[model samples]
Target: MSRWSGMPRTTRWVVRVIRPFLQVFTRRDWSGADRLPTGGYVLAPNHLSHLDPFLISHFMVDHGIAPRFLAKDTLMTLPVGGRLLRGTEQIPVYRNTEGAAESLQAAVRAVEAGQVVTIYPEGTLTRDPDAWPMSGRTGAVRVALATGRPLVPMAQWGAQEILWPYSRRLRLLPRKTVRIRIGDPVDLSDLEGRPLTEDLLHEATDRLMDTLTTMLAEVRGELPTRPRLDVRTLEPPRTTYKRLEP
Candidate 1:
């Protein structure tokens, strides 16, 4: 058995039950799944809702692939939820903390072992409120290039309408529709043998973001208003951990 086989059985059971319920409630539609690489790969998706990871996990399971996500370390502290997270072999990422490299190394090992690693390159959920993807961090590109894994750019919409981020509430009154679109894998063969530099990583990140922007625009049926970074500069650094009582 692979090291990932150690993922908690309880977590698997919970996901098996909960994912179906979520699908039914949201009336989700998934497309372009065939485009996902069967072997080791990185899934880069736009973050808009807390439900984004679960939605992607459901589709990955349906496709006969197991996705080990890179989640913030804080989520692993919730009572029942934390136990399930540990059981799933999900790696913890200490955002903006000194231990980020160690967390990233864990992700690298997972990818090298031919596992699917899902990440929100944007680091945090969109602060735009409209849920369009913002400029991404270089973590995804660094990990992908380091492991020589294929990067799959995924675009999703509708989850925000179900469980809106920042609203801290679920909208169950009106049944929401969720759509997931998996784009073709991005080839990074040209950057082989070279160190993963900030410039190259940023360029690749932009490519991923551009693809996501197109998909999101198609979903919303309109282009999003560009964000004013100057406003972001005025705010304090966001923390990766959510303050949930244990």
Candidate 2:
């Protein structure tokens, strides 16, 4: 059977609904689609705007991969939205609670099941004033390690142009061009089968972030003006999801 034909009803509905709107509203410049795997893999993308998930999902579904997001638990608790998310088999991440560790275990299972699970290593939108990717947490790396799935680094730019970070207002006028570039799976060959130490996770996460930043810069055709913002250095230590933090 065709891949779309095998997709859950909710996932098909999402593709039918969101993909068309994105195609109509924005110009797409997607590359490196050949890098996407047919089997289970961890999708690590840089988070730019709230609209990012839809755009990334569109790219994945168009290429015949059904994306399962590691979304906030609150999104999974919504009345209508929650049902759809559950029906589509997306994973819920319970942050700052006892259930936090459970989400990581769930992601590992999904990968082992041969499903695409997207995790924004940043945990939330970029804190960079220039919209560059910031330092990432280790949750994504941990999942990849446990399941031995390809941790793919995906970079997308221009979504922030349509919807700025933490801003509710959206500018759809005169169509914005969003570019998404996918890179080959991150080389975890050396670290694979090693003990999951704190320093090891951080190293893997840093490599993932560096690949994302480099890919994003290539898409934007310029280098980042400042070094990546490390959330740990903040006086208060800003954290979006405790479950994903290093």
Candidate 3:
């Protein structure tokens, strides 16, 4: 029996359909699957390409935990997307709406239920121009601190070569290398149980991003020269990829 044995029926069906298509164009070079906990924990990964989610999912399934994501509320509203997300037990965040808290609360529930909850701390694909992970949002930090769970920082590379972020072009003629690695859970013991303040949250959030960025730099074989860009403080660049979903 595999971890995917417990995956929602819809997730299994969808993965079955999608895996063959993806495998034809991509190959995996994943490490640290053994480091993944057999129980609930928060998974924070760098967002490089739109297709990276599925690549991450593939690794999780191979290792026996079904990865669940905080999907956009709009995706939940679509007939097909909604059905698929719901069927696969994906959580939706109603951003900027009164239901935003409910979305986060749902994620906490999922983790308590022994599910591996996935969040892109960057809150969007990196706008680093070089694609180093941008400054992360505070959602991942808040959830981990509230639940007192281990936050696993992960880094991935090579997805961008398959389908570049925002480009419609597909270079599937040659199989692309898809690499991923998971590091030890971040130790936030110092900040746990403290009064939740703006500064504390930012400090905790930066730790996650910094650990992830360091791991990412190792994966890329180069150090990042640019600082993490705060998209909130910056103007939106002209890019076709999705960003900042709640």
Candidate 4:
């Protein structure tokens, strides 16, 4: 059994409460669960909607993994919700501030301590018109390299159909099918033990994002177009392109 299944009582209770609600609105088509490690690791998933975390956690809990999400600091400050999140031991990220580095450190510590730390590599919802993954930040890579833990890429689709990105309206009439695929752990052996430099982090991050995109293509049964958007550069998606084979 995965050690994370024996999570804190509060987190277990929260999972119990949330699972039923997710089941009511979505059908799960999850695969590659056997690849999940029994020890500490990093989970990197593409961000599609605000609802992605709930959907991902539901999948993880069902498969005997406790997902410790790196969430926005604002969510950690909510009146009632924040208390629950803190009790559940979710990591809060203070983006673009002096405290930002602290979040990455906390994630590294979480992995080193035998917990599943989930970092959305994109850091935010993909701005791609088709919701394909954009260039990712190095937070996930940093956590894995720091702890020498497996960095698992989990690709998901269908949440956007439920709740479109940046929009509050939810479509609940016909239940949506959420497909999740856990790909093989990204291999960073070459970069392991090397000093983390800008070039090294970028290389590692690209390998992860490429694997995630390919896995997502498999789940969607289609190809993804490139050049991938670099959210940091605010690059616009190309109006024309050919799709790459999965």
> How far is 216's C-alpha from truth in model 2 (Å)?
0.9
Candidate 3, residue 10: the lDDT equals 94
1-246: candidate 4 lDDT, tens digit per residue: 554458877788887788888989899898999999878999999998879989999988887777689989999989999998998899999998999999989998889889899999999888777889999999999999989999999999999888776666778769999999998899999999999998999999999999999998988888877689887987443332222111
Q: Which pairs of residues clash in candidate 2, taking residues 3 or more apart in a chain or in different chains?
A: none
Selected candidate, larger TM-score, 2 vs 3: 3
Query: What are the TM-scores, per candidate, against the unseen true structure?
Result: 0.87, 0.92, 0.93, 0.91
Q: List the candidate 3 regions with Cα displacement exceeding 4 Å.
A: 237-246
Which numbered prediction scores highest in TM-score against the true structure? 3
Per-residue alpha-carbon lDDT of candidate 1 for residues 1-246, written as tens digits (9 for 90 to 100) = 543244457646766688768766877778998787766778899888788887777777777666588987998999977877887788999987888989989989988988888988888677664667888887888888988888888889888786765556667657777788888877677876687777888888887788888888887799977652222243443443232111
Clashing pairs in 4: none
Better of 1 and 2 by lDDT: 2
lDDT of 4 at 174: 97
Q: Pick the candidate with the highest lDDT.
A: 4
**Where is model 2 poorest over a 10-residue stretch in terms of lDDT?**
237-246
Q: lDDT of each model, Cα atoms only?
A: 0.77, 0.87, 0.83, 0.87
The TM-score, computed over Cα atoms with residue i paired to residue i, of candidate 1 is 0.87
**Candidate 1: 10-residue stretch with minimal lDDT:** 237-246
Model 3, residue 212: C-alpha shift (Å): 1.0
Q: Which stretches of candidate 2 lie over 4 Å from their true place?
A: 233-246
Residue pairs in clash, model 3: none
**lDDT rank, highest first?**
4, 2, 3, 1
